[model samples]
Target: MTSGPASSPITDELLVGALELERTDRGVLPHRLPAWARAQCFGGQAEGAQLAMAEAQPAGVRLALRTAATTVELDVVRTRKLYRGVPPRPDGVYDLLIDGKLAAQATATGGDAIHIDMSTGESHVERGPAATLTFTDLPAGEKDVELWLPHNEQAELVDLRADAPVAPVPRTGRRVWLHHGSSISQGSNAASASATWPAVAAASADVDLLNLGYSGAMMLDPFVARIFRDTPADALSLEIGINIVNGDTMRTRTFTPAVHGFLDTIREGHPTTPLSVVSPLYCPIHEDTPGPGTFDVEALREGRIRFTATGDPAEAKAGRLTLTVIRDALRRIVEQRSTHDPNLFYVDGLDLYGPADHDELPLPDALHPDDESHRRIGQRFAQRAFTA
Candidate 1:
């Protein structure tokens, strides 16, 4: 973490947002979930590496600097996961915003790659050459510049360098909007950090954002709700259903109370803040069928990875929750609450992506939306839900 002769180490003031940086032997790992939530995530068990990997991918973290430098360089050690038979996902994008507008994008050409056997779920790491992302030819005057981290990769920052010294940018004084959801919100297939649906909506709504979209996690957990209860947020939104269905973790009897409890906890701290409850997007596979979603064995046999619901739609009546069941429950819950709590609202996930969208956009994995769908969902969410 070097710096100019007169300045402190640039890494010391790297402007990490919504991430708690923990130093590691490699460098620094950015964790979205705080220490307490992390403890709860582990629950006195061993700190699970797989869960650690997921939370360490800094989906909304960035380095914002107000500086006058013609050239800037960032040293990053990225640990990328490679699944067998699946082409590698794109490198995490570094979106550079100068004066509040995207001016450039780049990716580190070298990093460590960990290959995982799909069948065995075992991983092996191969060390790779070092690479530095360099940005040059910047305008001279002091300007707000943000380097958005890749939403998909595990990036460890070793150093930051600039031709001139850098200073942290002041906040924009926008209201802070906190959001939570599943992989779709965590940015499953999104191309970049700034392009993630939540980031896009936050930009449109002009809010400082804290994204708690942990992939395969948003289980309507009490700890998550407690996190919201304590965070300083001017508004809140939760995208529910998909994860509940996929994990098959609970029946409707338990889910109803969980949703109510989740909301009650948030209301403890943010009694009057506008809160929006979003149902799941239209997913054909899970709309009627119950889940316990599993890998598509047939597709995997054909060398393609996909997901399928193992639970029958008939099981929904037996208390197993389907997307359809969850949506209806959420609508009813929000409707009942909104009569007395006028600030509460419900946005049908169908409005963001519905039967029409599922038809046209067709989730390729039968789970997550593609980049184009992400753009459309983000745009629609901004227009429909995000507002002062």
Candidate 2:
């Protein structure tokens, strides 16, 4: 292999979609949540640790520059989470885009690993060396380049080397759309970084994206609301309900006001911005069942991963939340709020992925959507929220 040219220092100007950059002993880590928000998470704290892990995945984050280089190399220290007994998770994918189109893809090998005991909720990390990812044979002219980081794993961008000097991409004046949601929005089972529904929607809608989708952690936290409140955006959207319901964190009495408070915080910063409050998609498992969703131990022992709701269906009568209950409440909230705040709107998640669509493109894990479903949802969301 031909040795690439001198290394270029990765700077803040070259990154997009990340809210903060953390300098680590090995490299710089991209964070979707600002440092202040991350400060609230503690490794020893269950919910706090989950938020920290989710935010570090860098869902919509990418390095963008203009270069004439025919070869590009990026060194990274990647850390992936694995279950002790369940099937291993796939390696995170890195997508390289040239002039707005996907040109190539790569994955770093032998970086680091986190082994978790599902039953005990304990985890430990195994250290590994950094890996170099190289892409060769570009079109041989100055072009805009985007290196989208993995949306499912933690990656520390160690260094960059290229055949030619690179400069930051000039601003395109695209409207920025900041969104927050659950795992589906975090690209759960999506094929690549840009394939995540939110990323796809932003691209199709021709807007810049700032994705703050934390898997299993979208509980309308005050810190999260504060992040949205402080961030700048032309438009905003929230994919709420699934994480709340499945986590079984709150009932209607608490959830309704929490939604109001979340929106209230955001509106403090962006009073008139177009904000869409989206409810959960059609999840049959949680449609009428209250959760505290649990791992399917049988499936896990068989080396398959699956989730099943554990809450009683009868609990719905006592204001316990289900997908159906959440959706109805969200609709009413939007209707009531829209009278005074016209920019605030509601998009039923069913419109994006309902029963009819589910019949054809079922969620692979009975939770997260498959790649095709993500595409469909992205297309529908772009049309409903952007074009409309």
Candidate 3:
């Protein structure tokens, strides 16, 4: 949805900008998060630019911000300046206005102090959103506040105002979610991101999203995990498979254990958080295949490849890796973990992205999904996976 200034009594706008102080091209910029940094899936940094701007603003001024919910955090740095009030209490909530409209209000509280080294030195503080702050009163005097953020090569400002808050509605905690995935759940180019089974399911159910998909990167690394862990989400979903099969990240002996370990790490803090684990979508590449992945660098570089060269049914029988293997792993995980963690659930990834989607939305790269596919997948995730 388009977010900017609101229409009503408040006319003044607070202008905030951010610029990088160092020479690195990867620092955070005002209003915009670093692309590479986002790719890393690290928390705290997502909204570093926006929070930096908020910190610099004077107390009692309303602020509007535009970005993903996961980007907000509280960590002070000399490089990042605050207007007044000796840094906000870790538990304090800051009103977040996006172009005169309130997008989300957040606060971070109750955590062991961690020291962050900026241009200054080590400082102890808690980071991450502790809770969502709600404002019932508005500050008097200046109707708005502007924040300037500087990082690396760019600088920009964001304006906020208390006079005009987005039209307030009853406190219904409804939320729309955006999600992304890889071939494992894309049905290997599952129809489209918007309709990638997940999108279809989400749409049939109703949801929202901004899907960023890369077919090869669904390895349960810290990056992808951070994306889900940090984002303000009511429900989250993950389809695991394909990459492990196609790239052959591990052996069958190691695959099951790896999956278990990955889930364990995520549940570290999100104990009661709702989660859905999806097995592989349908793909003929490893219908019954198993073992290590075959490599052909020359063909890969030429951008021409096939799932496997042997096409040997014997490989399937030998227990390499297949959809069944993934499904079994997921079931085992749910059965064992569900006793203690009631919120954890499982889904068949193929339900969203499957062979049928292939015919409807052909795979452009035979591996990674195209933009259209990303949308389809995102929409589906919002619907099926996100629904409580």
- Measured by TM-score, the strongest candidate is 2
Per-candidate TM-score against the hidden true structure: 0.92, 0.97, 0.47
| TM-score leaderboard ranking | 2, 1, 3
| Tens digit per residue, CA lDDT, model 3, 265-307 | 6676466777777777555556566424443446555655433
Off by over 4 Å in 1: 1-13, 43-50, 301-303
| lDDT digits (tens) for residues 105-186 of candidate 1 | 9988778999989778787999876578888888877787888888888788877778777888766576888899988997
Candidate number achieving the greatest lDDT relative to the actual structure: 2
Clashes of 2: 0
Show model 3 residue runs off by greater than 4 Å.
1-180, 183-213, 222-231, 290-313, 316-319, 356-365, 368-383
Looking at candidate 3, the ten consecutive residues that score lowest on lDDT are 148-157
lDDT of each: 0.82, 0.91, 0.44
Q: Model 1: clashing residue pairs?
A: none
- Candidate 1 lDDT (Cα, whole model)? 0.82
> Residue 50, candidate 2: how far off, in angstroms?
1.3
Candidate 1 lands at a TM-score of 0.92
lDDT tens readout by residue for model 2, 1-388: 3346769999998999999999999989999887767777654667687778899998999999898988989999999888878887678999999988999999999989999997798989999999999999988888999999999999999998899989998766879999999999999989999899998999899898999999999989898888888888989999999998889999989999999999999999999999999999998899999999978889888878788999999999998999999999999999999999999989999999999998999877889999999999999999999997
Name the candidate, 1 or 2, with the larger lDDT value.
2
By TM-score, the better pick of 2 and 3 is: 2
